[model samples]
Target: MSEIQEEAVLEQDQIIVESGRPKMLGYVFGFFAVTLLGYFLVNRYYMPAPAVNTAPAVRFAPSELLNDLNKRLAYLQNRTTGVSFYIHTIRKKENLWKLASKRHYSVHAIIGCNPQFETYDVSIGQKIIIPSRAGTLHPVQKNDSWQKIASRYKTTLPELVKYNNTALDIGYGDLVFVPDRRPDMALMNDKLREKYELRALFVSPLGGRLSSTFGRRKHPVTGQYKLHGGIDIAVKTGTWVGAAADGVVTLASDGVGHYGKAVFVDHQDGYVTHYGHLSKILVRPGQKVKARQLIARSGSTGRSTGPHLHFTIKKNDVSKDPLKFIW
Candidate 1:
């Protein structure tokens, strides 16, 4: 060999000698001959390997864990979040807490979803979002307590306090969030608005002119003095009946008598109103009714010849002339 080739070979031998590692190696048939032989023998049934005592892996899905947590913590979450309806959009690098603060939601609610983070620092494309009410504020009223506020907004008091930081203040007029109650309130509000083109304050069920006054009149059927408890409207027989106020219908009976088909609505204000001697009763007992909801078609039935509603206003269970309450 030449002198350079001889020197290169000598250097390689020296490195192998000092490091004792095979950096430049041909194909190695077995890394460890003894272990390889033993493994081969066991697989071929020459020798049986010792059994390994290993526990089965615990298997669970992230969604299942979240579901379990949600099921157990539903009440707590509800207490913090309240009933709501919202519109939300996902944005970059926004965290649940920050989004919640900006749009107003519970941090606990944000954590409930268990959002994902791509990097230690939030990324530009990272998405964080939540569902909540938008631009709806409850106008504060005098003597409004937390419970009253909650009732007005259709939310629990605890949720109002938590979401709006209301518990921090014991004084009156503390700002509180009105949870946009999911499912019903929004639609109901739409219905109310659609039905009443004018503002809700002026459209009273008793707003019509008192066409026919109540009490002793020359009876169209009987010429005798009979106690006329209900007022008669001068409208036609097909005139629609309206609810006097927000109430639950206690009874809707059609049995023919002095009071033929009758409707009794129990207003929560410790009073009830009765529409008697009608041809039709549309509502059933125990049905919750909104103000101005259609309850019956007016017609003359039983102990009457004219088509008019024998409307009576009862306060504290005592029947009073309907004219005193209605217009």
Candidate 2:
């Protein structure tokens, strides 16, 4: 009985050992298969390809290139010939004199670029074009030639024509830039120069509320729409009025025309200052007076609404805005 039991135990142990060998071999084979598959997938999809070199195709246009080169050459030639411009934005505390001095250009040079500047005074936040050199812009008149303009500015014809880069033909009102020519203040247009000089030479003779502005308005007494030639400064009766600038008294009388008791002073440069609506006249005709000198007293005289001084500035006998010359 003992020998048969030992033989059965040995047989069972052998069967168990033989079955475990196949399962172990299968697990090893599965792990190796998974590792090889992952390596193959990574190598196939995750690797970067090497870069290739290629030449780009070129396209050229002879006509376009020639035109562009010509433009660039013209621009360069103008720059070399002292013709270039830049714009300057006026900031707080910036003035024409200061800007001119800083930029090494004359004040007249800056004025030539901007025709709006009747005087050297410039306002804040104003944009002004500034030339690279000192010069002015002259408006072409009828029958104006490049040689004529050059002679006027004292420059050569070629230099004068070089200022204008766009076209060769010039017509009336075409502004021709004159480089390096500082304009004579006295030689400027009689009206324009007079207005510019009067701004600095004259002062407000009397300070008061502006009762009337110089423009087209309904006349208070006449009740008709007409151009008011002077600005009225509201003041009390017998308020002292003064001469605007040093000039010869042209007229001083009482009750003449619309200006009741008025005094007119001739500034001798196509400029005349008139003080009207006066209670009394202090200066007689042909008398010389200084600026701020008492000439008359304001009053509510002929065709007046109230006691005020009617002041006007005339250029070539044509009445202009008095406020432009005075306050």
Candidate 3:
């Protein structure tokens, strides 16, 4: 009876051990499968995807890029019309003076447009806005005619009208945009040449014959060889002395050495004229005179032998031959 019981118990124990090992193996496999499934779900649905590069690899040179940008900007500027504004970026070695001169604008005009610039001092890379054209704003006054206004501003009537987009008759207190109206060198030279060609038709400064020429000659009073800087015209005493050209009187006094009662007229076009040996000065400094206008009376004064008018012409402060211009 004891041997049969022992053998049965040993077989039952071995069977139980084998069955428990199989269950443990199943549980381990199930746990591994669950973890793998969880990782795949999270990666596919919840986690962010890896970044992908999409930009091109090519690069551009700085100069080429700048040139391209400038070309585009120029094209845009040219296409703009009417009253427009310009944004200027200050460059190296640039200042208000250089900018105004290059653009043919006055420093005041540049300052007017850019009031934000507290001072004339400007720095590179600073941005400023200005008008494309150069000019100033003028207020119309009573009794102001287009011709008078144009003449005052040194511009043509047509240009004034066009720029202001106004009628020929402007009202009092109306504002007008007056552009720089002075003619260029070429046009001025042409006008001067034409005027000299018709000198006979134009009024002469004095109705007298040429007494002395401009050059090196023996001085009449000094009795020495010296340079005669001007032409001498012998006219009767008290003869009316007329202006040779339209200009402003810059000097009208007797203090000028060797030229008593001298009168200097500035044509405002780089040309100036001097009339000396006058007895009476009819104009004052800053007085505007017209061509053929009365300026003084002739007399023998300031190292002169007789009553005569010594006339001199200057261009850009350099003395030039009066004969070449007197005709």
Candidate 4:
């Protein structure tokens, strides 16, 4: 081979080597750029997001939620009614009397709502059913008149008619809602005595001194502590017993236990007077009697130690001190 040919071949080899090296470097850089871009896109759009540190959401049972709603609805309904019924958790040193006084309710009103609680048997931490208003439910009897029913509940005819929105003549088996009707205290103190001057404030059941007062006492026969439901007026047997107030006879019989030959008169305004220990009952059930009218004869009847008349005054089935009401 000639020298010139050898030089040309060497120069060609150098050129090829230099050019191939540059192209190879460009290819490598392009592949690296594409790989880096692909990685960035996958992280931005395709990969799952990072976890966040937070508490799990709380869930409630469907039944529990429904019950809560129902309780709230019931409470609202009770408020809508004239009387609101609620559950009261008894507090320390709390009693029914204090509760009643604080709530402006009578002791008997509390008893009427909570029939399970005795006069002195309530204790602390007891759950009691409380009523916002005082009253009772009365079922109308056959041949019942509005005047008679209003007098029976101690409410006025207008109030009775308006509350029930019924006619003066009510039918049999009708339900009557009677609200607690009481004379205005301020007016009663001023006008009651003058208005009813002809009628005695209250007539004694029998002509005798009081033997025992109403309150807690030891039973004479049982020797156990008990609540004396009435006042005892000691008298001779066969003494006439007069009605304490004008009222209709609710019960007149010997059917009452511990009080034989008894008579019950229901006066207007939720007032009821009971005469017990009678030898003879002169009145029959449903008969109307005026105040001071003769209704029975006193005697030593069931659970009595001597001849006397047991007199009791009640408001809406709750007993009251007779002395507070009678003159």
State every prediction's TM-score relative to the real structure: 0.36, 0.43, 0.40, 0.40
What does candidate 1's lDDT look like per residue over 109-176, in tens digits? 33323222221123455433244543233433468766676666565644555454332322332223
Give the better candidate number (1 or 4) by TM-score.
4
lDDT of 2: 0.73
Q: Which candidate, 1 or 2, has the higher TM-score?
A: 2
User: Least accurate stretch of 10 residues (summed lDDT) in model 1?
Assistant: 112-121
Preferred candidate (lDDT higher): 1 or 2: 2
Residue-level lDDT of model 4, residues 213-278, one tens digit each, is 899999887899989988988889999999998889999998688898899999987889999889
Q: lDDT tens digits, residues 82-145, model 3?
A: 3345678999999776787787776656654442334456799987655666764454567987
List where candidate 1 sits over 4 angstroms from the true fold. Answer: 1-211
What C-alpha lDDT values do all the predictions have?
0.54, 0.73, 0.67, 0.66
> Model 4 clash pairs?
154-269
Per model, how many backbone clashes are there? 1, 0, 0, 1
lDDT of 4: 0.66
lDDT tens digits by residue: candidate 2, 175-202 = 5678777654554556568766656868
Q: Give the TM-score of candidate 2.
A: 0.43
The true-versus-predicted C-alpha distance at residue 109 of model 4, in Å, is: 35
Model 1, TM vs. native: 0.36
Give candidate 4 misplaced runs (Cα > 4 Å): 1-201
